[model samples]
Target chain A: MNKTQFSKFVEYLLKNNNVIAPQYNVEAKLIIAELKKTSDFYMGTELPLDSWKWFLLPPKQKMFDYKGEKMTEALPSVKKQIFLGVSILDMQALTLLNQIFEQDPYYQEIKKNTIIIGTSHMPKDNFSEYFAKFEENKLEHLQFDIFLAVQNGGYKIYTGSEDGQRFLDNFKYKDYKHVEYAGPIREEGLDLQMVSVMDGMQNFHDQKIWDDLGKRCISCGKCTIACPTCFCFRMFDKSHLEQGSGERNRCWDSCFYNEFTQVAGVAPSAPKHRLMATTAQKIYFWYEHHFVRTPGTYSLPGCVECGRCTRACPADIDIFQTQRDILAARNKKKEK
Target chain B: MINDYQTHNCKILKVESESSDSKIFTLSLPYKDFSFEAGQYVMASLPGFGEAPFSINSYFNEKKFIQLTIRKVGVLTSEINKKKKGDIIGIRGPYGNSFPIGIAKGKNVLIVAGGIAIEPVRPIILDAVNNPQKYKKVFIFYGCRDESAMLYVKEYPSWKKACDLNVALDNPKSKKYIKGPVTILFDVVNIPTDSIAYVCGPPIMYKFVLAKMLEKGFRPENIFISLERHMDCAQGVCQHCAIGTKYVCKDGPVFSYAELKDFKTWLSPI
Candidate 1:
């Protein structure tokens, strides 16, 4: 558990390669940028919506390119990526993602070559409850590689990974003088914003709550689009009628809309409000109860709380607040 | 790409348009001994249009050809309906669990179907008719909207002769129609508690019909209902069709009423 000053490590990365991080104000407000000049640059609080999801699974990347009878695999090559400002939720999701991709039928290509660079948060957002769960400490899972804990004077860098160790071994840092302040300290934050979506899912079958919520929905699919873990998509075959031009493309699909279930020609139900209802229900439903594995295992609910869904939403529905409302409504229903 | 999933060039040998949109197409493939069980399904494929899974409407014993009574509901089935003899096609497994004919042996069997779900029940109807000594008694309660929606009209007489048949169309007033809903037949039939009932239909039909069967004293374990799922991969790899942890493609397309006992609501497997 040898520690080194974080400045020494940041200096090393700046000298050799590109490093991305959210700069913090003296009061620790988030500034969206990598430290370009590093003249008194500090790490920010919670990470953005754009975390490591795309680093492994890129949105709209070709799964397999087919040429007539021939097909080519779009496998990603290994690269060294240093993600900055990782919250507890991000770290937890990373650990979960590693387990899934490394399961029996290994999704070997993505897992083989990726390392995460996590930063300790100073609790800017009120949602940093993960600190309380495991005694305000971070655990190394398969996904996250290096963790840089920022102390008041400097940083205590825990080189937990081989890749991290190798990078630090050759590089220089300040001193581990701030190690005392930098170690695990408890701050009563909300533990993983986990709604026992299980209990909620059980009660809300055909609940009238969706009736009001659906009216607020615009069906623009902003929620699914902004969700880091919404990997559900649909396939489309676009070819010329003469059978000459042939192209198959699958795009991100949202169940919150009518077209998602349009079989043959007629869709079974209304697409717009119903999709919102379905999406709301699916997320709130008792997914983990039935499956031995949690539904979140598939890189979903790993949302970094970017709130892009709120911004992109024309309906101006705050998803975070609505999610809480759902849990509360579920509880009320249970009591009834 | 094709190992366990091998493709066989198949074609629609004959098609009987039973109604406006519903057509029972008899198909021919090169392979012999294409043995399927009652209530099992096969994937029919057409080049450039991809493939669609259809229930085995024909008897499972046939090695020569396959039968699918498809209602033109989607793009695939619409294109499939247009397919005729010599049209190039492909087929995969008779994937999934089927109706338990052996389970019904020595017990009075009641088969109930609503809408197009009867397509899957067609083969079972044949099995019950051809093999009478295997079961003590057999009855099929088929329900539809009208004469236009009723399928396999030509084969109805033979089904009646083979076993008891109750046809319930929505329009009982018309001369071509029968009175009362198929659900009412459960009340009319003198099925004892020991009888095994099979119900297949839309969710609404299953809700009401299953209740009637239960009310009539058929135990949950003794009743089976086929489930429809949002199938992506017919293989278990795709969890699209999951109901709880059970994959409809693998664990069942047909589950006992007891299986539905725990599913709070019929939701796709996450």
Candidate 2:
């Protein structure tokens, strides 16, 4: 589709369905929001400050509500929406999220009702090499509705799911080839870069790198909020003014917080309860979750190399730099 | 179609005060087919007070009821202590891997528990008690702060009939029980080196107890430890209870020493 035709299609989409796209806010900083007009769409090499997580897994969501000790499951009611101009990195992130929350009802509630339209736009600062370039084979593992491969002046469109083809057909767009939804793993097995970093961070220890990050990190957890894949959460119960009533809620929780690992009790019951005591251990835990644990369990890269965390970090603790340091430490240990 | 976070409403069948700060609440399952193995845990909640994971203290074969021996700790548990018989509470999961009873069959079974940690391992003791021929011999080394802090004391006589039960206390009022940490009982008792040991206790206790077990020639693989961490989701999605790649809620609240030794953080000190 050409740029003019695509604009018409987006306008048609905005008129009919809830369309979400990256647009510049008042300060001219890019963010993902509901698109009201074609003029608001901002598709470029610069990645948006926020990823799609805020849409799928809201920062605060009500899991269940109660009245006089009677519990009722209260999942979010979502409308069918369209995510237009999503980048490949974000697509990989969405794929990881889909697998992680495959069993999660709340997440699935939002995910099933949404249609993702991915683009071939690659951010300049991508650390992971696989996503640095867009190709046909790369589409095999990632889950997306429609993909727009960038051409000279327009886009070469491809459909991932039946929903994508239907969406395109509904818009009266020209026929596009459909890509089958292959599972996450490719013939190469897991990504070697992810494996290297995971091994380096877990097996090979680097105290200095973590200590430096610990010193720099303010523990504000802005990085977690900005990162697309940081999905750790803690549940909280809010009591209403009425005696036995309120709602059970969950919000994004950071490992950097001391309370994240607190098992409540006194003396014998609470002994050895808090896991990460110091700031360094907490900071290391955040990285370990992204670099080690996620990859170890899911057989996919936890981090999409988005670099938004570094952008949002107040203290300039670079994730890519830490990964390099982890690899360096591992190599040094191996040489010995 | 399954909602992993959705909990079933269970009525409290009975409630018994176990100690000063702990209560054993037996719950009637909402579903008839509800069953869980030893070492598995459930996320129990009082509507307005949130939820927390508690180990199922009842035996696996207990058809009608499941007992949770909860220490009054934090907001949720403190509220649960106030619940009465016939009161309703929320419960989800028989989550996490259970103790490998199949492997322990035909072998000597050793159980070491400390303080409130004995709740999770009670099922193993009950299993041995119910089916005496399931294992060769059963030994329990239970330690608490003192005699007043001990749990399930009334059941000791019944437990003694089929198994060798030993008790230890940090401070004993009389000369009746051995005085010291549970690790001290290792010296008093004759542990089969080839026996499979199930150990659950405070994290600090694991350091000393595991060292003694390793010194006693028990293979690291033969010993399984139940880990406790602050957990929100009994499913692995929430990273609260993760140690390395293992989710204490899913892959384990119980893990072989072999799996734990390689953990970089969270399970044990590096």
Candidate 3:
């Protein structure tokens, strides 16, 4: 399909669904938002400021509603939505989220009514070797509705799901190949970079590195907000004006906050029972979650290596540098 | 798709004061065939307040109702304490892996608890009391701040009939209990090193109790410990109760020492 055909396809999708695509905001900053026109769409290698998670898993979601001792599950009421111009890196993040929240009804409700269209556009500063170079074979490992492999003039269309194939067929376009949805694991096994970093953080203990990071990190948690795969959340209850009425909500929570690990009965008069008391411990937890816990749990890389966290950090705490430090520490220990 | 966060409304059947700051509330089973094992907990909540995890202190075999001995600790528990009989509260789960009762069967059982940490282990104690012949011997070592902080005092007579029950207090007003931390009772009593030990306490108590157990020639694999953490979703999706790769809410609130020893962040964060 040529550039003219792709514009017509976008127009067809916008007729019945809310099209979310990468576009330049008023500030000229690239971000993922609702696309009003085909001209507003910015298809480039540069990553948007925010990820597509805010669409699938909202920042604050209502889990349940309560009234006079009765509680009912509050699944999200969603409309048909299409995510266009999604980079391959963010696709990996979405795939991981799909696995993590497979049993979550709230996430599933929004996911069922949504369509994902991925592109082969690789970010300029991409650090992940797994996604550095996009290939037709890589599409088998990724989860998406449709994928556009950028070619000479337009794109070589590939359909990952039946929805993608139907969407294209309905647009009166059939020049597309359908790719089966392969499992998350690659045929070769776990990625070497993910394993090495996980081993480095778990087996190789370096206090100096974390302590240095602790000093530099302000615990502002900007990195968590920016990172695509950071899905830590806390459940809370909000009361309405009427008695015995409210909703149970889960909002995005960051591990950098003091209250993240805080338990009940934590008063000055009572004993101090906080697990992550110091900034260093909290920072280590944040890294450990990405490098160690996620891989161990899901057999998937936690950090997508998007460098969004590094860009969002106010303290200039470089995640890539920290990972290098962890690797260096592991190598030094191995030598001994 | 099943909503994992969905909670069931359970009516409070009975409320009895256990200690100065705690009360035991018996609640009707949330659903039919709702069964739970020892060391498991339920996410108890009330509207307008929040939710918190509480150990299911009731006997595992009881079909009629479940009991939760909630101590007035934080905002949620304070609200829970105010609830009376006939009041309804939201509850979900019997989440997390239970104690290794099968492994402990036919072996000498040693139960150690400190303060309110004894709540989760009450089912195990009750099991030993009911069967008595299931294990070779059962010994309970409970430590508290004072007499006022002691729990399950009324059940002491029945428990003592089936097992060796020893009580220790930090500050004792009378000669009813030993005058020291629970670890001191380790020296006072001659428990067999070959026994299966179950321990639950404040984070500080684990260090001393583990040291004392190790000193007593107990094997790491033979001991099971229950860890406490601030939990939100009992389904393990929430990261609050995460320790290393394990979600304490899902993988465990109870874990064997052998499994826990490998995790550096089990007791505290690295």
Candidate 4:
């Protein structure tokens, strides 16, 4: 598809559904938001500061409403929406989220109504190998409706699901090839980087690395907020002023907080009984979640190597450096 | 698939006071088919308060009703303590892996539980009680803070009939119970090295009890432990109950010692 046709396609999407794409926010930082015009689209190397997760998994969402003893399911009421200019790395994150929350009613309600449009725009400092270059074979593994592979002047189009083909057909763009949606597993087995990192974290002991990170990391949880795949949440019930009426809600929660691991029934005045008491332990738990637990469960790379955590860190704790330290610890353990 | 988070309404059929702090609540299920294995837990909730995980104390064969032995610990449990018979509440799941009863089938069974942790293993004891010939022998070593904190006192006489039952308390008012912690019972009773042991207790208790169990020649694979964590979503999406790579909510509230020993951070202060 040419630039003119892409612009027309964007216009068509906007007219039919909510068209959200990468655009500059009020602070001149790139973010994913609803676009008013075709000129608002930002197609470039620089990735948005915030990921597209906020749209699918909001910061706070109501699960159900309860009146006294009865509960009514609170499914999201979302119109058909198109996510345009999503980078390959972000697509990986979204795909992982899809798998994790497959049985989730709240997430599935919004996910079914959403369409993802991916771009061939590769960021300069990406760490993952699979998504460094956009390949046709990689198209099947990723969960995207449509993909735009950048050519010299315009773009090469590929359709992942039947929904993508239907959208393309409606726009009379029949030149696109349909890539069958294979499951998230790669043919070559698990991602080697994830395997190595998970081994290093699980098999190897690295107290010094975690202690250093603890000293540096303020535990502001900015990294979790910035990360596209950090989907840990906490649920609570808020009672209205009226008698016996309330809404049960869930909000995005970070492992950095002490309350995350605090045992449920401990009294207020009593000393808190938690899993990770020290700051270093909390930091280790966060890394373990991304590098080890996720890969162990899904056999997919948990960290997309987005490096958003590094960017968001107040104490300048670089994730790449931490990975190196973990590997070093692993090697040291092997030598012993 | 149905929404995993959505809870089923259950009415309290009977509430038996176990102690000053805990109560055993028998709940009538909204649906008749609800069943759970030993060591698995349910998310109990009061509409205006919140939800917390409690191990199902009743036997799995009890189809019409399930029982939860709850200790008043915090906001949710404190509210639950206020609930009486005929009151309505919400519950979801039957979640997590159960204790390895299949492995304990023909083998001798040893159960060690501390304080309120006895709730999870109660199902195992009840199972053994019903099928006395299934195992060669059954032994229960229970420990509590004091005499008043002991659970299922009325069932002890019947339990002692088919199995060897021992009780240890921090402070005992009667000579019938031994003195000291639950770990002390390990020294009091001669545990068969080949017996399958199931332990449930606080983090500190695991350190001593596991050491004693290992010293007694119980293999790591043959010993199972039920871990407690602050869980929100028992479905594993919530990170509250994560210990290492495993979600205690989903992967286990129960795990073999072999699986747990490999975790660098399975319990705090490791």
**Please, what is the whole-model Cα lDDT of each candidate in the order they appear?**
0.59, 0.88, 0.91, 0.88
Q: Each model's interface RMSD (Å)?
A: 6.1, 2.4, 1.9, 1.9
Angstrom error of the Cα, residue B214, model 4: value is: 1.1
Q: Write the per-residue lDDT of candidate 1 for residues B140-248, one digit (tens) a residue.
A: 8888877777788888878877788877888755775567788877776676668788778865587788778777777899888887765544654334454554567
Q: Sort candidate 1 into its docking category.
A: incorrect
Superior candidate under DockQ, 1 versus 3: 3
TM-score, every prediction: 0.71, 0.97, 0.98, 0.97
Candidate 3 iRMSD, 1 decimal: 1.9
lDDT of 3 by residue, A23-119 (tens): 9999999989998988899987999999999999899999888888888888899989999999998999999999999999999999999999999
Cα error, residue A164 of model 3, in Å, equals 0.6
Q: Which 10 consecutive positions of candidate 2 chain A have the poorest summed lDDT?
A: A264-273
Question: Cα lDDT for residue A8, model 3?
Answer: 89
TM-score of chain A of 3: 0.97
lDDT of 4 by residue, B51-129 (tens): 9899999988888899998887788888898998999879998899999899888889999899889999998889888
CA lDDT of A209 in candidate 1? 46
- Model 2, A32-147: lDDT tens digits are 99998999999888899999999999999998888875778899999999999999999999999999999888999999999999998988877978877788888979999999
Model 3 clashing residue pairs (backbone):
none
Query: Where is model 3 more than 4 Å wrong at Cα?
Result: A266-272
Worst 10 residues of 1 chain B by lDDT: B1-10
User: A292 in model 3: Cα distance from truth in Å?
Assistant: 0.9
Best of the candidates, lDDT: 3
